[model samples]
Structures are given as C-alpha cells and as structure tokens.
Target: MDSPNSARYSSRRSGETSRRHRWLGGCRDANPDNRSNVRASSQNIMSATLHTRESFDHSPVMAEEIVALFGEVPHGVVIDATLGGAGHTTRLLEAYPWMSVLGIDQDDMAIEHAAALRANSADIAQRLDVQRGRFDSIDTFLAQRNIDSISGALFDLGVSSPQLDMADRGFSYRQDGPLDMRMDTNAQLSAADVVTGYEVQQLTDVLRNNADERFAFRIAKAIVAARPIANTTQLAEIVANAIPAPARRTGGHPAKRTFQAIRIEVNKELDILPRALHDAIRATAPGGRVAVLSYHSGEDRIVKQAFRDAESNPLVQTVASPFQHHQSANKLVRKVKVAERPSAREIELNPRASSARLRVIEKVGS
Candidate 1:
C-alpha cells in the first residue's frame, strides 16, 4: 500500500520531453489500453466509501468471502490486521451479531476517522477496539489485553484508497507531492529517505524484490544520476525516461513499479509479515483461521510459505483451546486457495482488486 518522488531528467532524457505528454510527458500514457489497473483501484475505493453506522464500507476486496470464512470459525474477536477504514471490521461485526473486532492500523488519519465513527454510536464503540499500531506486532497487542486466542485474523495487504487519493501523503505518482510515502505519519523513514539515500545496488534490489521491475538496474542508475529529486511528479518524470520508450507505450504508467517499491521499503511492509502471520496462526483457536488478501507477488509468496510451514512444521505450536492452554505438537492447518480473480465484476469495477490473491488456512488440530 504506498507514493510520490522527484528527480530531474539526466542528459540522455533531456530532449525526449517533446516526444512525450505535456504533463510528465510519456509518464502519463495517453493510450486507453495502458491505464494502470492498480491505480484505477482508487476509483473503486472512492465508490465504496458509503458511510454506514457500522463503519464506512470501504469496498474491501472479497468482504463477503471473508465474512463467510469466519462464520464457521469459533465466534470471538477477529483481528483486522490492516484496518484502514474499518470496512472489513464493521462488515464482520454486522455479519455475525456475536462477533467483535480488534481493529489496528498505523495511519493516524484512519485511527482518527474510526474514533469519530465509533463516538457517534455506543454500539460501535463497544464492539470495536481501535488501536494505533502495526499488525506485525499482533502478539504484543493480544498479550497486553490478556487475550490468548482469536477466532480468526484478516490481513488486507497494500495501501488503502484513502492513502492513495491523498496526493500530499505521497502514495501516488499521478499528483505532485513531497516524497513522504509513510503509512504511519510518525515513521522516520520516508520516500524521501529511500529515493535520495539508498545506494544503487540497494535501490535496485528494492525495485526488483518489491515490484519485480524488469529494468531495476537501469532505473536505479538513472535515479542515482538524477539525484535530489524533490517531489512525486519529478520522480515520475525520471522513472519514465529511464525505461525504453516502447515499454512505456504499453504499461499504464512508467513510475508505478518504482513508486510501489519505494513505498514498500519506506514502510518495511514485507519485513514483519511472516512473523505476524505465524503469530496470528499460533494464537488462533483450533477451528479458527488466518485469511490474507495480498495485492502483489511478494506478499502472496510470504503468506503461502507461512501457512505451508504451519501445516508441515511440527515445532510450530498453537493454542489448544480458547485461552486455556498451549501445545508444542505440530499445528495442523488446511490451506484454502481461492480461484484466481474469483470476482470478475470486482476487478472490472476496481482495477486494483485484479491483483488481489486471497489465501486462507483453517486450524484443525494441534
């Protein structure tokens, strides 16, 4: 879930402006076929923001399926790991009257909005426990409340629509903004640090590892050469020039991959995911589940491996029942993989949902 950047064009790219668009030139592909699926997701997000007493229905990807998955689990508190606007949280609460949500997010804006939403109704306030924190530290949050086990956990990975639409937050290259793509406003590391500070090799790795950009090395070199990038618009221009013109004609935007990579790095989105998923699995009741909606290849890979390991690794322990006891034996888990793009309509309506992959694991034994 990510940002903006700015770097002046290098000598090789100085003259190519006339050949591109008036605004960011080739950066904003004029071809309708090249409209970015991921960026287009913001439109769906905006549409989904229908306000309700339960919470804002932020058009959570696969909300119905998520609710159904939790329906069979032992009814209790479910962790909304990435609680952007409490879309899934409120949905779950409404789905099962007995269900409650432990909502968490690092973004101050999201937390404040939820607080206001809760204040308007005492029911929401009692049913939802909003916390300002990262999902990777789920264990600590649970232990602090003396909570030992959960019914299920849901992680909708990636930046939310609100984060992307706010250009000042620096999650989009479509608008000109400072290089500050931090999910948590308080995080010391920002996109500014990433674009201006990272060395070529490190930047290249970030690009390739985070977004699978084919021109990682070339982009890294171009960015380094055009140092002191000031804003997202400037960064977009540099990235567009770094790639071959032919390639730019096809992708929705030349800077999408780079912006995503930098945002991932600034937030360390992948670093703590494995541990968080494992912890969520460990604390779940035998019949409970951990569901993840990963938006990119890197996140999906981590979720797949963590669940697979829990099923096969005997050393992995789990809570035996409720909050009563724990066991050291193998934690048996059944993996449930949903169909690729199960929601064709969802994808057509919300382009960003196209890349979303849902993975679920139900704990059967310990």
Candidate 2:
C-alpha cells in the first residue's frame, strides 16, 4: 500500500525487457519430461532479478477455503485487500467468473506484478482493477471508483513469501540483507529505525506484544547496546545471542519472533488492521462475505474480536427492545464459527502456509 507521505519507488528495472525475454526463452527451451526442475530453475532466475512480476512467487494459504467462502457471493466486485502475489484474487476470479476484483496492496511492486499478470491473462485483465493503497483506506478507494457496495472482501495478512525470500526486502531472519522491512517500500519507518531509535522499554513492549518473545527485555537491551546495528544478519545474530541457549535450540529460529516483532512495529500492521476490517464489513452489501487469513496470534485476536463485536450489533438490540418498538434495523454480519487452519498436507507442500488461520463472516441483514 502507498503510504500517505512517502515518495513512490520506481518499479521499472533497466534490463527488464531483456530479462523478460530471457525468462521466456528459458521457458520455451524446457523439456516437458523435466518440467519440475525447469520450473524451479525459472523461479530461481526470477528471484535473482529485481522485483519482476514473476518474482512474487507465493502460494496462497487455504486457497480452497477462501474460494468456498467468497465465491458464493452474488455477482459484484470482490476486494482482495492484501493482494500479495494475486494468488487469492486469481483463484476467486476464476471460481466466480461474474465477480470482478479490486486488488489493493501497499507494495508498489505487488501492484506492478498484478498488472503484468493481468496483461497476460485476457479474462482476468478485463475484470481485475489493481489499486495502490492500504486496506485501511478501502472505503475511500471504493468511493473514488464510484463503487457503492462489494460482494466480498479478503484479507490475507502478513508478509508474502517473495518479500521474505528476497534478501534485499529484509523480512527474512535467515538471509542477510539491509534492515528494511517496510511492506510499502515507500513507508518512512523501517526495521533499522525501530532497532536503533526505540528506547529499551518501548522495544521490549514491541517484541513482547507483537511476537510474545520471552526474552524481549534481554533482546531489547542487546539491540540497544549494539546501537549502529547494520543489516538484518547483525540484528538477527544479536537477538539469537541474547536468548538463552536451550530456548534458542527448540524454536525454529531464535531471531524469528524478534524480526516479526520489529517488522510489525515498522509497518504499524496491528494498529490499522481493526480499521480495515470495519471498513470491509461496512463496504460489503447484505449477504456478502468477508474473509481474513491471518498468520499470527495478534492478527487472529483482532479479527476474532472485530467479528464478535459486529455479530452483537446494536441494531439487533434496538429492534428487539420493547420500548423502541422498531420493526427493522440494520443487522451486522456474524462469524460463521472459529477460524480454520491449514491441514498437515498443505503445510507440508507449503510450509509458509503453516501458520495461516482463516476466519470468515457474512453480512446478515439489510
């Protein structure tokens, strides 16, 4: 999503034309018998380049469930609020041919990538509208587009795989890169700023609340001491060293939580999410649906509470009250049930999807 004050970054690369031709040539020369290896090679080549359309290689988490929930919405525009790699948007568009998608993303690279994908596919290109903005501004975007209400909305929260795998983006704890983790590259705050600028207590709260890091205090202190921390690797190493040895051995990576914490703070992810959810619910028409695919506990908690609050609409109370004697009132959407997580098989195929939790709610009354 485009930040309010930040300058937009150029999406074009100098050798993009040549690189595209090279990628196409590689595709054409691949042997059908060894297609799997060729596909992997192509992905690697794509990743090596700057932010090309193909570089955003991400598998949408719980794609089937997302489609099932949103596809049934009556013909109208569906908002893909996150639009990471356009994975969920493409699936929804394909499943419900009548439904168009408004794909919103903070990352300009994602918008460019979606446009390129749209260009290649005639049907999707005709129906997909790529917009550069954050989900929190969903209402304003729809208003500017002259759209009144939407059939469905989908929010697949958190960073995409390409964002993590691309070392330069600095979302990954494994790879060494610049300490930049802004989802909207144009955003002012970065991981480096949080690490170097935040006071020890503030940093500790960020780590503790964002990721529930047990050694938040120790990690925060270490980061402060290591003040001029340069890149992702340096911060990751400090976080790892600060944590107790036994604790570090069991978790996937010691720096994983800390990195997630910093990234969340830098992006202000949690703060805006509640507003975005409310905007989505308000924008959706009666009987329409809203689905959220969240990766972390904090995100899920926010989603859960928002849905619960919506379900207990004041209108319902007003309508039922004897004193009010209201015949009809606008009833908000109710949560279908608890959130759904990916199965073991899906997790095996795409480990990045392991933490995904999908919660769906549908508009109930006029």
Candidate 3:
C-alpha cells in the first residue's frame, strides 16, 4: 500500500519499527500453539495468527456463510473491497480456489500483510491481485485494472482485531496510547486532532450522528474543557469524568461511545460506506451476489439502504421478493434477508464479534 504521499512521516520510523518488531517476536512465540489450535478446530479451514512478520491472518467472522453465499454465484472474479486482515478474503479464496480476487484496503500494514500471506499459499497467492486503495474508489481501481465485471463481492466492514488489540493504532479506548485512530495511518487527520480541535457543538453533532450516544453534549463539553488532550488515556479519563455515577453503574465504560464517535469522524467511515456499496453493486455482474458484514447501526443502515436501492433499481432485477411468494423472480431468500447475528458460540470465542451482523443480496439480470 505504498503511496508517495504517505511517506512523509519517516521520522516516526523508529517508533513503528520497534512496535512492529515486538509484534513479530511475540507472534513467533505464539505461532506453533495458534497453528495447532487452528488445525484442531472445526473443518479444514486454513487459518493463522496475524503478525508483522507474517501476512494478514486474522480469522474471518461467519466464514462458512460468507463462502456459501459466494459459492452460490457463478465462476468469475470477486472483489473484497474492505480487505481488512484479509480474513474474509482468505476464506473466499479457499472456497473458490479457481476464482480470482481483487483485494483492496487502505491500510498499508494490511496490504503488506495480505501480500505476504498470499505469497505463502501458492494457489491463492497466484490467483490474487492486491491493490492499495479505499473501498470508495472501487470504480477507479477497477478501471485502472481494466476489470469491469465481477461475479460477486464482499465487504467485511469496520476495524480489524489487530487494529483494536494493537495499542499504537489508537482504535481502542482501553489501550493507553496516542489518540490517532486513522485506519490509514497516512491520513493527515488523527483522532487526537479531532478531539482537541472540534468545538463542543461540532463534537456533539459527530457523536450523535455517528453512534447516537445519548451523552454526546456532556461528553463534548468535557472534551472541550480538557483541551490539549494528547493521549488515549487522557481523553478516556475526561469522558469517564463526564458520566454521572449512577448512569455508569449499569452501562459499559463511559469513554466507549466517545472514542467510537471520534474514530468514525477521523476515518470518515460513514461517508464512504454508502458510496462503496453503490460501487460494488455497479461492478457486480447480473446474477452475482454481494455480502456485507456490518458491526454497527450506522454501517448497517448504509448497507441496508444501498442494498434496497440496488434490488429495486430498474437496471437490476431482484432475486427474492419481500414476501414468500411462489412465483418470485429469483427467490425470497436471495433478497435482502433479515440480518443475521453471530451465534452465541462465536460471541463466546470472540467478544468483539458479538455485535456483528451479516447481510447478503443476490443480483438478478438487468
């Protein structure tokens, strides 16, 4: 994901190198145990632990369903527009070994990691064409690659586990680190800048718009008072201080909502999501399918709307009807099905995956 414009922060090399090296060392120690666990797990799904030394190996959520959804489509190309740890991409590649994939991501580390992982698997590595870009620019990316049609597409939206677990990324309010939450570190706007720069009204608007945080005004007021907040801990402490003792008793950490709002603002996540979904619909060939995995209300709303638009548009026929009619064009199940939540077993294994919802749509002929 090397970009000429993204290389301006060379001075931060020492810090990044130290952190990545530490991760690589830690990964080596856990490699055998993790690999053995993966092998012992259900079915013959290729899986591995993610690390700086290795390629993106984070496990996919709802992998079986994702692969199944795409498998129902015909042979051709598939696009993974949000190739986060390439978790879903890996699964997609494995399920359709004969199919080619154009995997895209804005994160430089993720792109590098995916490339490395692809190199490790001779079959998948050969079939993959990696690109570094945001999902919103799907059309431009496709044009650049001279790819106009795709059999299917998948977007496993939102942050990856590594981004959250790694303290330096500044995604999690729990980890003590800087407030820089840009998914693409190269982005000039950091979470710290948003927190310290945005006015109370602006901050409140962002919080309310992004996450519907009820205490947005209170949190915004606290943030403005705590100006010049440099790190994650400082911001988290101020947010915590804003919450009343009684309200904090039942709900989770007070800073959780504030941090989420700031991260969404920093990344322009909501703004790009709908456009990405539209581009995916346009790129998909007739009879193709698109699956989206969203973790929040805002993201799911965008997916829901974009899917509805695609299904209703005159250019594409809807596979499934709203009702369970016998003479439906494609099938009711192929229409925007009721969003499915992760199983309790999955939530038990990965608490972060609890809020995840899977949505699938199939495209009929124009």
Question: Number of the top candidate by TM-score?
Answer: 3
Per-residue lDDT of model 1, residues 29-68, tens digit only? 1224423332332332222222231221235666656766
How do all models score by TM-score?
Answer: 0.80, 0.81, 0.82
Residue 199 displacement in candidate 1 (angstroms): 0.9
Off-target runs (Cα >4 Å) in candidate 2 are 1-57, 314-336
Off by over 4 Å in 1: 1-57, 314-340
Q: Which ten residues in a row have the lowest lDDT in candidate 1?
A: 19-28
lDDT of 2 at 61: 71
Worst 10 residues of 2 by lDDT: 1-10
RMSD of each: 11.3, 9.3, 7.3
At residue 303, candidate 2 shows an lDDT of: 87
Clashing pairs in 3: 319-331, 320-331
lDDT of each: 0.70, 0.70, 0.68
Q: Which lDDT tens digits does candidate 2 get at residues 266-356? A: 8999999999998888888876778887788888888888877776763111111111222333333222354577778766766666677
Indicate whether candidate 1 or candidate 2 has the larger TM-score.
Answer: 2
Task: Name every residue pair that clashes in candidate 2.
Answer: 1-105, 1-106, 1-107
